[model samples]
Target: MALNLNDLGIFVQAVEHGSFAAAGRRLGMPKSTISKRVAELEAMLGARLIHRTSRSFSLTDVGRDFFEHARASIIEAENAETIVRTRLGEPSGTVRLTTSVPTAQFTLAPLLDRLAARYPKLLLSLHVTDRFVDIVQEGFDIAIRSHQQPLPDSALVQRRMAAHDFYIVAAPSYLDRYGRPEKPADLAGHNAIVANAAETSWRLLAADGTLQRALVNPVMAADEPFVLLRAASSGIGITVLPTSVCATAVIDGTLERVLPEWTAGQITTTILMPHRRGQLPAVRAVVDFLLEHADAQSGVLNSLANA
Candidate 1:
């Protein structure tokens, strides 16, 4: 017997909507028609797909399995149609994305505005948090992250956006009172406002290419970078921060780079997607936008560094 895509879709819809009546309402078909199509599908497969009552229904074991595959097939078909439609100049879909809070605030907000202006039909659902989110399990189409450590091997496609350098900073008042450090070793005696308690050391590279680690005395520690930034700015102690987050503060004279000659470390910014194949046009558009904006920001940073 030949399998019918339409019947499969109807059966899946019935399963999803919980009954033929609800599925019929959603699909703009009569309840009787919905029931008949599902029944036809079960007959073709030679299995009882659903256990029905006068007022309710439930999927049989075979129906539950079939529903999963049928739902996927329907989605694939819709995505295929969307690909053609997008090529013809109409890209419309919701793209769910996840990223760190700091990146969202300091980097992605303006870029998202630009994306909205360019793709009026494309909608974005963005989740911003400090915790690492599982994009696949969370139903996210894309994720952006900044990490100093190497990422583990994964099936997801990874794209490097930029490298962010870390800067150790202190309020001018704190420096005047505690005395400025002439070398990394001097940091050992000073009160430190660390982002992580476990990270009580700052690694620095010297002009002669020598590397050194300075163990800090932490008076305050927090997981959030903004909290550390605020603590450092309030003269609680010296703290390390990403250059991107500290750039404006440095310019505004709220904080100054402590060891202007050295960096703590470099964090790589990366974007990830589930797969390269069958990527929706909306997803592709946002990814390209992010890469372009990241490159432009990197150029600006490089120019500032030279100056």
Candidate 2:
């Protein structure tokens, strides 16, 4: 049966206000009309809700139980309305974000600081990992990732934030001791810090549209770039890394670009959301802020790509 919410609301108000006349005054209706609606509600449920009397108002055993549940529904409805109204204004509320470790460290996390300053009521929760996550299943409002190939197929709205390529970089001390590679062929003799233990081949693109390949001796290996980056900065060996991961170290002179004239491959930074339509204001605001600063976030690549 289709429940009459209006009748349910009137019934609850009648019990709370303690009299039909009082419920009518609060709801702006006649006492008889309020009493009739409550009666209709009781009849629809096939139960006695109120025991009406001239001197007092009372409830049946079933009526008391129903009243408790009905009042909760009314409060929830009011709160839902309040949330909608809040969203229409300042984009207030918590936005749950998930991102890869590198992007979170170098790109998205910094942009959120600016977002927080702009929207004081906005809150952010960040989850960082290297694995691909199911944003919908994981209850994330937004996701950011940097990748070399296309992201896996999904319904999420994917926006490319920035694009950059990998550069060979190492500490100045490493190059000073072992000397720097002046050409692709020179890498064959260099000690390389690689992502894995297996022998790795690097395909570099030269300045004049020539593709060159070289193999380097792997002195150390790690699956995570941050670890490899730290090793590279300690003068361990040359490593291929995207500029975003190494930009701060490079800027601070902890790491120096090697074979600056060649790029290994390109990578894209992208933002994903479960859906663009019907996103809460807070989620939308964060997405806009990310897209706005996407370039500035990756500007390190452009600055040093030619340097």
Candidate 3:
């Protein structure tokens, strides 16, 4: 009799979730589908694993015994996979990644090239968006997020990457036209090009380690970092953005730093995975490769080109 390991997983899921309907919901299938798979698993084993009823269900004595066995089998299978991933010389598989457009362009894009050169067998697929992504439901192997503070509680496992201060920048022409702000509060009267309308408020860290809060009027708003950079470099207004997004403009003098004595909020880049355990060798290698390229001294741009 042929047995399906997936049926075992579904059986365990049914038992743990208390009902086929619940398990199906978690697994993104129908309850009838769950029931059919469980029945097939029982047929293959030649022993019933659940006692079905109109309203509820119960496990038979044999079912009770087999549930533990099924769960153990799943765990052992996971362990075997872990062993294979860790013991392998070179990790090779397709790793699907999702992140914002800016990160994809200035960060992950170059790294993907590096990964291909370093591990020729490995494959990568990237998705770029600024919307919230359900990592599990969306089927992405990994996700990246940059935030000013710790993210809200979630089930996804997180790995901290490079952290760089948010830089408030403007074109030299803008400074010359509007005059540089002498203090954080001085920015209140200036035009502000923001990532979005919602980001009009900024918290700046002064030279003395004091916190300064300033709210600027939004003159223009764009979701993509490069768009915002282009606007800022065109003498539109001062904008506060993560250093990774502004590093290149600052280096080439397209944009000049505003309030050199103060920095905007510190932003941290994080790598998020669906689960900490049972990570594929390819996924693990991709994560480590990213961490290896994370430059603490410099965020991206020039560093990524050379590193």
Per-model TM values vs. the true structure: 0.73, 0.70, 0.74
The local lDDT score (0 to 100) that residue 247 gets in candidate 3 is 77
> Which pairs of residues collide in candidate 1?
none
RMSD of each: 6.2, 13.3, 5.2
Q: Whole-model lDDT for model 3 versus the true structure?
A: 0.81
lDDT of each prediction vs. the true structure?
Answer: 0.82, 0.81, 0.81
Per-residue lDDT of model 2, residues 121-180, tens digit only? 888889998887766545577888888889888788888888877888999999999998
Task: Residues 1-307, candidate 3: write the lDDT tens digits.
Answer: 6667898889987886678887786678998999999988887788888988988788999999998988788878866876886677577667878898888887787677778998887888788998998776556779998886788888888998778777889999999998999888889899999877887778888767999789898989887788888899889999976777777788788888888777877878899987722266788888888888885335454353233
lDDT for residue 26 in candidate 1, whole number 0-100: 52
lDDT of 1 by residue, 67-115 (tens): 8888788889878887788678856778888899988977787677788
Model 1 off-target regions past 4 Å? 1-43, 46-80, 87-90, 276-278
What is the lDDT for 271 in model 3?
92
